[model samples]
Target: MPRFAANLSMMFNEVPFLDRFASARAAGFEGVEFLFPYEFPADELRKRLNGEGLTQALFNLPPGDWAKGERGMASLPGRQQEFRDSVKKALDYAATLNCRLLHCMAGLVPAEVSLTTATSVYAANLAWAAEQAVPAGVKLVIEPINHRDMPGYFLNTQAQGADIIAAIGSDRIGLQFDVYHVQVTEGDITKRMERYMPVIAHMQIADVPARNEPGTGEIGWSYVFHRMDELNYQGWVGCEYRPAGDTVAGLSWRERFAR
Candidate 1:
């Protein structure tokens, strides 16, 4: 069976951020992931993981000014320096937390920035980031988010992420295949999963339309999970979805769909 990691940022919200680690452990998750770990000290976060005996599955490099709506700076033209700084900070935290996967968000492209320019900047930035991450034992990942959820986002297809990985060398970076985004942007999720499995380093899941637990929406969870196993995908699958009701109450999907 595929390993599932509770996304503490979305799951276990009933308690404090630090407390969610224990909650996730009690709920039977052996691994955990969150959006960002910059707010708290790395030692403190490491302490929580150690205390709960949880593996840090994945987390993102700092996106610039999240409150101001800047999703990420990797593809932004003028933010290259800031993006590099963000990467260094993230690597520091990853070393402390022993995290192997880091998702690099492709930010929304400004109207004035042509796709050509943005693509060039993004490629260069990722190449540089990948070079830095090699020594830290960290591999970077990029997710193609649906435009409906994140309009103007730079990357939006598995083909695009795969192409980027091909150009940058797969050893340094890989794809973060999120079922919710794939279903929203494009159908044929299984074919896409199979086609991209080789380059995929991490996975995330949520049902479409409502972005809730498995079996709560339109996705065929059994087939998806089965397909994952068949493909021999041995990476962490982050539960990056909002709960429909009580988080624990909604976790029955694991027994129902992930069996």
Candidate 2:
């Protein structure tokens, strides 16, 4: 069976933290992912998840003061300490929540930084994260946001993400393949999925253009899901799209997956 997860950050925007898990479960998702989850107590979150029977498929390290426009600086030289600190905190949280994976945010890139420098920084940080995560039975996933959606972001391509994971060379270090980002950046979604499926640790989706529910945009989600099924992908397929109206109203297309 293909497990589906609702990204709380994208869906159920009106729900509170303590109640979001149930909302996601009520919305028919078997699991949930989030950008971050350090806002509340981990034990309490674990208890809530246990009660709701919702799995923590994915959650990210803090993006570091988004209000200051800091969209993560993990691969920057001077910010290494900040990146490690963020990872440490996230790992502690993941342990409490019994999460299987954690996304190590690769923040915005500086104009002066070379690609060599960025890749080296990311590889080094990921190698360290892999070392820390493997013992805890958690994988470290790095995402590639499309340039259009996140300009100057350090990691922005499936190939680039694969290279970074290859550099780290650990089972614990892998890619978070977001179909929405990859579709915007790379049009050949099926081929790219097939090519990187071996190294992809997580998957997320929405639609391009408006980033709404599946089937609302140019990407052929039916084909995409079919391809995923054909590949026998056992990981969670996360719904990481914005709701055009109310969350539930926008999720009616889920009936397509009822079979």
**Which candidate should be chosen as best, given lDDT against the real structure?**
1
lDDT of 1 by residue, 1-259 (tens): 8999999999988999999999999999999999999999999999999999999999999999999999999999999999999999999999999999999988999999999999999999999999999998999999999989999999999999999999999999999999999999998999999999999999999998989989889999999999999999999999999999999999999998888
Shift in Å, residue 127, candidate 2? 0.9
Candidate 2, residues 99-172, lDDT tens digits: the string is 98998888887899997898788778878878888998889888899999788999888888888777777487
Q: Model 2 clash pairs?
A: 72-107
Lowest summed lDDT across 10 adjacent residues in model 1 is found at 208-217
TM-scores, all candidates, are: 0.99, 0.96
Which stretches in model 1 have alpha-carbon errors above 4 Å? none
lDDT of 2: 0.85
